[model samples]
Target: MFTVLPAAGGYTMSENTKVIARIRRLMALGTRNSNPHEAARAVALAQRLMQRHGLTPDMLSLHDIQESVCQNLTSNAEKVPAWLSSLATVVCMATGCRCWFGWHIHTSCSGVKSVRRSLHFYGFSGRAEVALYIYTVLQRQLRADTDGQIAGYRKRRILKNTLRRRADQFREGWVSGVWQVLQSFAPSECENSMLQRWLAQRHTGDTLGNVNVRAAGKCRGDRAARVAGWLAGRDTEVHQGLTGAQAQQQITAGGCTHE
Candidate 1:
């Protein structure tokens, strides 16, 4: 996690930083293990070290310092979908982040303007990057799963009309099921407090808004599509190497925002 370099002039890594890095590395390895006993032991060791040092995960993971806001996870549409908001909620819960959907105005070289939908995240610097990575992975998986479901329904002649509505239902169900999967990973009280402070300091004047999704009407194929989507969402998995070079570089980057 934290690499030590010999002092070129007068600077050197602190002992506390070294210990936190080791703890983070251990925690990352523990979470990535397939064997339950080994994983438990690794995490336990990490926790013990943290206790001895009076350190928390936020300190070990560098979340207690350097918060940032990341944005421009574009949906490439004029109107944002309700499922995207739901997906953002799931990502926020899993990563200890906050998310909002907004629009971006862009002009082409020919002077044509367009409105594009985008997603934004606010949290510790690493949290936003992690949120972006998870969102990208899950969004791709959800789209692929929904496309497969729609194609299967077409082949079976089960979906003759209301295709858009049916797709929305499936996506909504998928987000719900994914939320169930990640519900237990919510942030700790300390981390939540830090997030609240960040929001209060950064978004003090921001307006509260909501995404409006039309309610789905009763129909025959609605249940089937939603069930399929729920099943797919349950099967979706996300594995991130938090200590990898790419992630480390991004986490330590100079820019405050990911763009």
Candidate 2:
């Protein structure tokens, strides 16, 4: 039978257990530090210790595998953009989580009622929280870019239809680029197995669904906009433990939210 161990198992801390704990702490610090140099050093030290101790991914991610939770991130828009869904996919892959669209009824302050959509993330609590935080940051960044694009289009007296099309293309390209950078960090087989088991137990009757995102770059000047967005996404500094530019800054579990 498969056994789950607590973060601190009841037994005395073995030498290897201590090493694992130390490595975990170092990694946490590395991801949270704003100082790039210190973050890099801490990550490197953690790697060295892992190597010294012959630590495997399964061992390092033990705590995560043992615990799972669901986090719902309500979308500001009732109908989420296709790019937003793609962005969530990238975040889920990077953070070892699974995501699905969900909705709840919300009543406005003025007593108006509407359906509010949210993205539900299921994974280890830390991974779910990290996924939510990263999604929020990237969502804002994408919106900001589109807003700037819209402003420029308005200055040039461009049609609203063209502006919307280009903005959508840009967001699509951005998600594609970010996916290239972080897809390698997807969850291991062991983690996936644990997650599937947890889902079966806790999220029974859940079904898989596909989000059909269109290809980017169809209209005139669309290629340029997509290229610009791809470059921006490639340059995006992912502040979490995932492999990317400036691999620092993960919110601690039960930390404050930007929402």
Candidate 3:
């Protein structure tokens, strides 16, 4: 005969699992290693590649970042922060690249006043930064090469297609969609709702629609401005990692509502 368990235990740690083990061996020390030297060496390759791709222009800073993280994180006798190992494993399987973003997110994703925890939960926000960098650089390259049309062809519009209330658009729901990508790169992390969704219900602009509506307020052009404020207010580290262009892209991709 078998026995029934209470809450649950031993779920597979796949891209799907958000929190594999709260009691992870190294919930804190992590893989970076406390000495800092060894952990830096392990992730050096990843940092270099990101820098080369313009993900990091201040090349030296990348080195320092590695060292700092490892120094604080690694431990000779203690288990490495399971978060790092899990993140590293996912990077190898999916991106086939090192955990450049993973490392970046580990240290940078902080300051979530209302959200709780940090963005380090997933890798895609870093990837989002990378993608935006790629998108911007490509845009610049295109402008120099062929006509604007050529650049347009290579460009991806992150703009929304009206309110994302429909099922088809819903599948590409900004929060869920981006969340899915980020989770693939990082260890199990809690998902974030698109700030706009919350702001729409919370922020109000010029007295056009509801005049003084709070929480999902009506708006004119100021809606975009308000959303911008929300993102900036949410997390500066994440804000720093992303380019202004990406900000516009994410807004356009899903920042409007007809209702």
Model 1 ranges with Cα > 4 A deviation:
1-80, 107-111, 156-161, 180-183, 213-217, 240-259
Tell me each candidate's TM-score.
0.57, 0.59, 0.17
**Model 1: how far residue 6 lies from native, Å:** 50
Clashes counted in candidate 1 amount to: 0
Worst 10 residues of 3 by lDDT: 60-69
Candidate 2 lDDT, 39-126, residue by residue in tens = 9999899999988877755455433433222234424443456677778878876776776665455688999987555566666546
**CA shift at 131, candidate 1, in angstroms?**
1.0
Task: Give the Cα error of residue 55 in candidate 1, in Å.
Answer: 24
Root-mean-square deviation (CA) per prediction: 14.1, 13.3, 22.5
What are the lDDT scores of the predictions, listed in order? Answer: 0.62, 0.61, 0.26
Which residue ranges in model 2 land beyond 4 Å of their true spot? 1-81, 179-183, 205-208, 212-217, 240-259
